[model samples]
Target: MQHVRVYTDACLLFVEHKVSWDDARKSCRSFGGDLVMIKDSAKQKFILDSLIFEHWNTQNIWIGATDKAKEGDWRWIDGSQVTYGNFANGQGNNHNTRRFIFSDGSNEDCALIRRSDGGLWHDYPCAFGLGSLGYHYTYACEFTRSGYGTTIGPTNQTGSTDISNHTSSMAPITSTIETMAPSTANPNIETPAPTTAMPNVETPAPTTMANIETPAPTTLPNSETPAATMSNIIGKKRRL
Candidate 1:
């Protein structure tokens, strides 16, 4: 299917890759857009009534609204205050601010459009069940003549799973190093100690040193000096 659909004012790119809210925003931004911001009722209706129902099959989709900057004070990615919110009843309580509700244990700081009740908006945890927790959904990117916009939703495809994979990768590298260090150091150190002791046992080094350094230095200098002196004397006698 065509990934992008153009509108009168903006263009919408429907992405099938599921990811965390942060990852979704990044994906949109990568192509010159942020998450789709339904600023007013017209934009909201266009998405819920037409775009989503027509082109998408997922139940939930992330939006650009977030209260991460300040609890209970939600804003769009452009830092504009959310003036019109079509929130579902009891969904955007903004309760306990940054604290978790032990029942669900997540701070519902980001927004999504859930299609169950005619596609009303709801706040969800930014991280939710994505990024190694193994859950994610498709998202959309909106673009204008000026720039870009973004969103995401449930149940399939790989996007941000690699975010936490570094921790898993570190485990094997650490184990391999630990295994190699001891094996190499122990054999080299222990073998050298025994070989060094064997050299001490043989003790033949003093005799070889005595022959190498002695007699040669003493006899060579004496023999060469006399021969040179005799040659000089013979040259002088011949001249005389």
Candidate 2:
């Protein structure tokens, strides 16, 4: 999600979500710039062509311009001059509407790019909530041309910066591109798979019961037989 588009002077953070103009400015301020300031048409064209939702699909971004301070006095939140505007054909008209009521009955005064139109700058009340009139807008962040050269993520899509937690230098790093569909070939280069067959292995057999042998029985001689002969001789002497 750490996507940022890099350039020589500044970087554009493409946050493709429903963000209010106020929250959008806060998000940009967290990155060191309070919303992008389109000083001229060149900057505006750069933002329109380079910094956005890839197909950017009618999803507008909130700029730093707002007339909340004084109606029709649309000025940059950083107190810069309001030199140029790329407002839509019918937008930025006499209605310099000051009173605002969000969908949830909230009030805000800010500006936004019209995604439904051609990314034209439009004066809008800053609020996106759940109600009959709730409207949410996507936003982009800008970092003033700093020599630190630090940039947001490749495209700033799904990426965020926590200013309070960071202690490192704000130097921009190399750019990052969004992940595309996995490709089998690049510049028509295809990776070949290894076709080598593995060596054959033998399986062992199962074990069973073992065989045994029995020994023959043996007998010993007796000693009482001699007494029988002495008895026979005594009987003969008696007969004599």
Candidate 3:
């Protein structure tokens, strides 16, 4: 099968195909890509005019463009609607008799194209057993931008102190369009509070027991009874 590729600078996506319309679309979606949809006269004309050869079996290759998601609402696979469509005179008026057929066969509701002569579009039957232009069954494809290039900013920051202190730098920001200056005039700008010194504590003296008072002991009664007992004993001895 022959591989066909289509792209435009205005759209970020592109489509290429070498398989049936269904397979082509599946491949596109696998990579977050879609088949090319001719939305306007300009895009249609651009696609037709850019053709270099006519290897496509049908007039147009199936594009990611379709109204299948919402019948009759015709939208590209990317959710874009048909702002423009080039239907050869009286085309697209099939009275809804056919939904998926292209021009090559019956029952094919996909799109088809001729890469050699920049042919117009028509419905074809997708189930028809007819082989492609070269009997090839696979198409490898991808999308790309025209005249557009991507730029990457520096990822490392070992050079200048300005880069290290981006918040305080005066360099104009070029990555985005909107720019703003730091609020240097605001009087309410926050300032860190000062830290307080810790207090010095002195060790206390040891306690002593000498200052404690002791209670005095009470004295017993005098021995007057013992003296009288001794006199009585002496008198008894004298009597004995």
Please, what is the TM-score per model?
0.53, 0.53, 0.39
Q: After superposition, how far is residue 62 of candidate 2 from its true place, in Å?
A: 1.0
Using lDDT as the measure, the top candidate is 1
* Model 1 agreement with the true structure over 1-240: per-residue lDDT tens digits: 225444445655566667877788888787677788888776676666444434577777788888887777889888998888887776564443323434341456788888877778877777755322433656666677345332222212212111211211110011011234345344443344334343345545554434454454444454444445788989999999
Candidate 3's residue-wise lDDT over 145-172, tens digit each?
4322222122111121221112211112
Query: Cα deviation of 228 in candidate 1 (Å)?
Result: 99
lDDT of 3: 0.43
- What is the Å distance of residue 152 in model 3 from its true position? 23
lDDT (10s digit) by residue, model 2, range 165-202: 22212234555557888977668657797879777777
Which of the two candidates, 1 or 2, achieves a greater lDDT against the reference? 1
TM-score of 2: 0.53
From the highest lDDT down, the ranking of the candidates is 1, 2, 3
**Model 3 misplaced stretches (Cα beyond 4 Å):** 1-17, 53-59, 93-108, 114-118, 125-240
Better of 2 and 3 by lDDT: 2
| Per-model CA lDDT versus the true structure | 0.61, 0.60, 0.43
* Model 1 residue 168 CA deviation in Å: 47
Cα error, candidate 3, residue 116 (Å): 9.3
